[model samples]
Target: MDITDNLAAVRRKKLSRRAFNRTLLSAGVGMVATPLIGTRQVVAQETEQGTIFTWGGYDVGELYTSYEAANGALPNFAIFGGTEEALTKMRGGFTPDIAHPCNAGLKRWVDTGMFQPIDTSRLSNWGDVIPELVAMDGNDAGDGQPWLAPFDWGGTSITYRTDLFELEEEESWDMLWDKRYAGQLGSLASGGDAWWCGAIKAGVPFGEIATDEAFEKISAAMREQRPLIRVYTDDTTTLEQALSSGEMAAAMTWNSSAVALASEGIPVRFARPKEGALTWVCGLMVHKDAPNLDKAYEIIDSLLSVEAGKFMINDYGYGHSNAKSFDQFDAQTLVGLGLSKDPGDILSAGHFMIPQSQEWETRMNETFEMIKAGF
Candidate 1:
């Protein structure tokens, strides 16, 4: 079935929180079991090697070619819908050598005491990784060691069908809430991204987003825009399909969706919102009680290599953390993709979602859920 058909079919079934979280990060559609790479027998035998608990589609062998070449096998893989769920599972005795979490959740993850500091010296490519990403809000743990290794970076913006929506003004977040497009707009279902997008529309600066007044204003704006949305889903594939079929005039989406849609010959544009886009950086962390420490470091190093970075930018449409990765893509291609050779420039033009307390996160998510349900 096509992506739209798959989304329609999946919507008929009840989606669990875990499934929603996974789809949120990976930007994938449909419900499927956690993909276990390699065979069960191989996984069982490779238990001595490391296992990575991460977002779906990230376990691809190409991203870890070096590790596979050395060990003659791939690491066992597990999947989690979100960082909190993964942290909960780890606290309850589910151990994986490494886990992936974004900068917005790094503080909370570190507070859980589930991850140990990364020894950059052990990662051969560490020297070439972008310094700006290395210096992001939560990368450092206040000690000499760092907690998170910079990986994929990208923006969140409006993806619209150029053939459907004529821009009266420059592209802006207001497009998503325009009354003219009521019943034809879509948005991301998760607050992790949607809330920040709302903040941008509300003109609430990123640093002030946690204040009571900011919350009130942002909440009101989201509620006002709610009726205009035809669908609120975490599935980027579905969003792309809807745009391709002219089912949705505009939707909030990540950079990857725009690339995917355009590559398929869809006349779509990934907007550089007038208020600026929402940007983020996500990466890997080793478990505090990791069993295969050496292999875990190797896995991280491989992911930081230029080869892996090329795969990420060209295939996944994300900006890699390695500065050298930009060498593979020409200047025009980077500009067309809304990326800069230096990730800092892109981040500076946009607002980066910051870490929030678990309590605040809970309340924001709960409030967003109510708004989505028309409460």
Candidate 2:
């Protein structure tokens, strides 16, 4: 599909709720969506705050309020559909001042030699950031400097409509595999998420995911699912639209989708699969040759602020790295959002994606894409 006009429109500004998901589909990214309460309004201005290469939804004015207060305008942004795509561009010499990639690919990203260790001392809000998130696997860049500044944390699980979808049993990842919902189930296109979810369904442990035997098992499991899925897309808009209209009974989605839908009075459940949910922490990394190094730090500081945390938690339904972000909401409210004051409480209960080699990443993505293509 020639979505150049669509892509250009979405890239020009932050998106509204109605337009957000469709823009996501156009951008070739999936799962992430707009806040249920409102869309972020960004006043476009000349770039004074550097550039942040992130997913489509994070470019809002609210997350950058502190940075904008310090500088005159928000940073220039370049959006990508997924982390893999973001990394591929940067590796090809398209460096942004800051890039957002999650923890699972930390080692491969660090090994790429295009990034520099973030000196935590530059960030004023560093002290208030959650310790565990900061200490995630492969984050520490040797002499105590970290590779990425911890940002949002959340889970990936099935989000299904309670009213329309008949729950044959308590929610399970199997809802996506059920023959009953064949041709009505949606899935993420990126192997970064879906492949890992496949491992879980195939009963392969994260530690053994790279093994030859494990690969065959997961491939078979995915191929079994291929015939059943109506669409394989990363666009949250497409998945959420089908789900909201009752065209799809269930789908594999991030926590953000369910949060947005439930807030709008949609009868949905972000499943608590007996098999653990996939958990992750995505954060910021500075390019080695960041033109706006100081502004990059400023961007990190702004996102780490309690105010940013409040917006991320209250609106997007993701856990924030700033512990103080949880202070604004009462315990019950956080619980209702499927979050906790302590992120560890949630993270520990779920399956964290283990870091993998570049070779493994390439193979997994290739295999999953092949399966999606009916190979």
lDDT of each: 0.87, 0.87
For model 2, how does the per-residue alpha-carbon lDDT over 53-134 read when each residue is reduced to its tens digit?
9987899989998899988788888999986787889878886889888888888888899899999999999999899888
Model 1 per-residue lDDT tens digits across residues 75-182? 888887666677778889888899988888888888888889999889999999888888877667766678999888999999999999978799999899899999
Using lDDT as the measure, which candidate wins?
2
Q: What TM-score quantifies how close candidate 2 is to the native fold? A: 0.87
Candidate 2 segments whose C-alpha is farther than 4 A from its true place: 1-47
Model 1, runs deviating above 4 Å = 1-43, 46-48
Candidate 2 has an lDDT of: 0.87
Listed per model in order, the count of residue pairs whose N, CA or C atoms clash below 3 Å is 1, 2
lDDT of 1: 0.87
